[model samples]
Target: MKYDFGEAIDRCKTNSLKYDFIEERGYPADILPLWVADMDFKIPHETAVAIKKSAEHGIYGYTEPKDSYYRALSGWFEKHFDYPIRQEWVLKTPGVVFALSLAVRAFTKEGDAVLIQRPVYHPFSHVVLNNDRKLINNPLVLKDGKYCIDFDDFEKKIVENNIRLFIFCSPHNPVGRVWTTEELTKIAEICIKHHCIVVSDEIHCDFVLSGHKHRILSSLSQEIADNTILCTAPSKTFNLAGLQAANIVITNPELRKQMYKELTRTGYSQLNSVGLAACQSSYEYGEGWLSQLKEYLGENLKYIRHFLAEHLPQVKLIEPEGTYLLWLDFRETGIEPSELDEFMKHKAKLWLNSGEIFGKEGLGFQRLNIACPRTYLEQAMIRLKTAIDSLL
Candidate 1:
């Protein structure tokens, strides 16, 4: 492999939020930090070289994204997703989190409702409420250990709440289902009918593991594309979240105008210089590295599935179709959410995301980020098995 995903890079002294803040976050100091979505792998050498080239210039002046930046991004989207996006449709932002917040402001009024599918990335709920908009949750239905959209409840919420916007997570976080083309089309159709401005956060789009293909929400229909704010970044895919580069693609003239206006009003027009360089370099040259990383992650997912089946029969992996995150159901273990948290913290000495934080529906589940070296994953699985054995 051209890039090393197995090498254990020490992150302790780097002041990484995932690594350096475990004590502050009330977790054991020695606990493996898999709660945050960031990976432990080194940034691809090509990306590192690009950042070094920029740093050698020694001028940290305010900067804007160059034409090359746009080309790199547009080319990547086109190549990977087969979705042709115009450069004019692209708008840069510091992060996808910012993009979601900005979309909340741009599309909805102060009191209008924004609907989100629960057991989603936690930030989606906060983005709506933080902007003084009402958060209407249409929780997904989990049947036979697979999660699917509850279309009945979704339509019901839209009608009852008069939802003005829908924040959709494609290649969804935690549960990790890559919505199929039919699913995307149906979701788009529902949003179009209700006149909901759809904000499709596709940050995890590039992280879809083997056998799962991503369907870009905008590619479903022109009507959907026009109404959709498609957000993506190299952050999750390339492990460059600290660099904070993300984009929002709006094909519709009016929607684009509104987002641009809101962005300008907030003085967020300029791109993060380091972020832009990382984004451009990663999209253009990190393909080989990403390919290997996905292959390695596929192994990790397989190990997890087999490990759970062999050792912890009560806990089930909700078969991740995409994303490095694994959603594990502990409901059969009959552990209360609070008891599970204590066991995970003290007994397992692991810091995984408690599913309840995603939503109340997340109870009886925990999210495990598998984007780490094999040795660490082995240790995690062993510790988890020990903890569960003690509980039983």
Candidate 2:
């Protein structure tokens, strides 16, 4: 591979929220972090080169995304995902989280209920609750070691609460099940029937593992697309979260105008020029690098699964359909969430996200970000095995 996934880049001295700020985040500084969902690998070379060129220009200025940028992004979707997106539908935001918050504010009022599938991303809950909206959890059911949507429960809750908005995580986080096309259709139908707006966060769409394809919820149909506010970004796939370039696509003009007005009201207009360059470079010329990165991540997942099977048999890995995140079921260990948190931090000398934060349903689980070099994961597994063995 031209890019080395095995190479461990030193992120400790950098202002890396994942690594450097561990102490600030209340985790022990000595613990190896596997909690945050960003890659340890350097971004694709062309993206770096593009950002560097922009930096070399010396005048940091406010910017709007160029047609070339939109073309690159749209063209990428067309070539890679077989989905064609128009430039008019695209709204620029610094990050998907912000995009979600914008969507929440745009579509709903204070006291309106926003629905989400729990044991999912923690921020979905945050964005809803923080914005003064009522949060409704439709927890994903863990059956036979994989997560599945409870369709009846989902529609029932929406009807019961009269939910005003739904925040959908595609290629869901924590419990890494990629929602099937049929599943997305049902979700869309339910939202349309209920007159609830859908915010589909497709940030992790590009990181799908082999044999599973990610279908943009908007691509389901024009009606579905019209009802959906799709949030996408190159951040997750290209290791550019800090760069914060999200492309929010909304098909309905009034919805687009509403979101744009909210964004303007919040005083967010121009995007960072370096981020723009990075995003354009990534979507335009980073496919080969992404291919290699995905291959590397695939092996990393396999390594972690095999490592657990051989060393920590009691801990079950929920086979991931997409996303580099792995949801490990450790309920059999019989440790409560707080105790397990302490064990991982103090005894194991490692940091992994406690599943409880995702929702109550994630209590006995651990969300492991496997987007790092294999050597890092192997070391983590060794520490984890030692810790679990001691407990057992």
Candidate 3:
């Protein structure tokens, strides 16, 4: 690989949330942070160069994306994801979560229900509930260690609660499962029938593993496309989350207007200066880096599987079809949710996202981010094994 995936870069003193503020997050300063979604990898060389070039110019003014920005974004999607994104359909945001909150405020009124599938990204529920919207969850069924959408429960709840907006996580977070075209079609069909607007979070869409293919939820059909708000970002793909850049794509003019107005109320305008450069450069020049990173990440996943099999066989790694996050099931260990969290935090000295935070169904599960250097991952696993062995 041209890029060094094994290089361990110390993130301390960088004011990184995942690195610097471990104690504040309730983990020891010495804790191995394998929790956050951001990767330990550096941004592509070209993307770094672009940001550096802008910084050297010494003009720190509010900036917006030029034509090149849209071309880069559109070209990348067309080439990689097979989704043709029109320039007009794109709206820039600081981050996907911020955009999601804006979308909730725009599309749904307070007291209206918004549907989400759990265990999902915790922020999905946060955005809905924090906005005073009624949060409805149609939990995903874990069958044979793979997560499947509950289509009947999904539609039934939509009808019963009069859900106006649906936050759909494609290539879902925490629990990684890339929705197949057939699954996406069923969801779109439900949304269209229910007169619901689908806020499809496609941020992790680019991270699917070898066997699975990511189908753009909106790209399935025109009706789906018109009813969809496709939220995407180069942050997770290129490790530019600190720069805080994302794009929200809306094809329907009416829905687009509603979202745009909502965004304006939040006093949000103009993209981050460095973030735009990082995003454009990454899309135009970072595909090779991303391609190799995906392979390396697959290796990381394999390492985790083998490590657990040999050491902590009681813990099952839920097979992930996409994303670098691994959902580890510890039910066989007979650990309760709070106890499991304590074991990971205090006993293992490993900082991981407690599964119950995703939703109640995620009890006895822990989400470990495997997007870091292999050496650190090995250390984390050893720590975990030591903790488990203590129970024996």
Candidate 4:
């Protein structure tokens, strides 16, 4: 492979949230962190070079992306997802979460309801509550070893709560279930019928595993496109979260206007210069690197499956369909939900995201990020096995 995912680059003292602040986050200083969504792999060579080029220019003035940047960004979506994006439909933001917060304020008023699927990315809840909006959850049901959305409850909640906005996670975080075309269509239909604006966060759209496809939610129909705010970024794709750049697509003129108004209210504009260069470069030249990274991640997934089956069968792998995050069910281990975090930190000496933070439905489960080197995963598995074995 042209890209080496096996090399473990030291992230310590880099002020990395995942590596540098373990102790500050209440985990042991020595604990191995597999919690955050970012990868441990180096970004594509072209992306790094572009960033260095931008930095070497000396003056870090306020910068905006050129038409070429938009071409590259649009070209990526058209090539990968077959979704054509009008350059004017794109809005730049620091991150997807920031876009979600902006959408909440733009589309809904205080005390107005916004719907989200539970056991999802925690920020979906935070964005609503933080903005004084009503939070309504349509919890995804686990059926026959897979997570499925309850469409009836989804529509019911929107109608009952008078929800005007829906924050959606495609190829959802934590559980790692990529929404099928049929599923996305259903969601789009429900939101349209209810006249609710959909903010589809597709940051993990590029990280899908084998045998699954991620459809852009708005690409289904003209009507769906009119009502959807599609949030996307290269942060997860190229492991450039620290750079903080995201492209938010809003096709509807009125919705875009409102979002622009909210963005103006925040007094924020133009992505960081380095982030702009990295994003444009990655979208243009990082495909080969991303392809190899996915293959390596697929192998890492297999390793976890085999290791767990052979050494820690009590823990059930939820079987991720997309993203590098694995949702592991430890219910069979007889670990109480309240004590699970302590067990992972103290016993396993491994830092993972406790499922409860996603929502009540996430209890008894843990979100493990496998976007690191195979050796890191092997060590994490051994740590987990030893921790579980101690109970016996």
Query: TM-score of each candidate?
Result: 0.98, 0.98, 0.98, 0.99
Badly placed stretches (over 4 Å) of model 2 are 25-27
Please give the lDDT score for candidate 3: 0.90
**Compared with the true structure, what per-residue lDDT tens digits does model 3 show for residues 18-66?**
8888767667667888998999988789999999999999998988788
Query: Model 4 — which ten-residue stretch has the worst lDDT?
Result: 21-30
lDDT of each: 0.88, 0.89, 0.90, 0.93
Residue pair clashes in candidate 1: none
Residues 186-303, model 2: lDDT tens digits: 9999889999889998888988877888999998899999999999999999999998788999999999999999999899888899999999999999999999998888899889
lDDT of 4 at 175: 86
Lowest-sum lDDT 10-residue window in model 3: 22-31
What is the C-alpha local distance difference test score of candidate 2?
0.89
C-alpha RMSD values across all candidates: 1.2, 1.2, 1.0, 0.9
lDDT string for model 1 (330-370, tens) is: 98886787688777888799888989989999988899999
Error (Å) of candidate 4 at residue 337 is 1.3
Give candidate 3's TM-score: 0.98
Q: In angstroms, how far off is 294's CA in candidate 2?
A: 0.8
RMSD of 3: 1.0
Model 4 scores a C-alpha lDDT of: 0.93
Top-lDDT candidate index: 4
Of models 1 and 3, which has the larger lDDT? 3
Task: Order the candidates by lDDT, highest first.
Answer: 4, 3, 2, 1
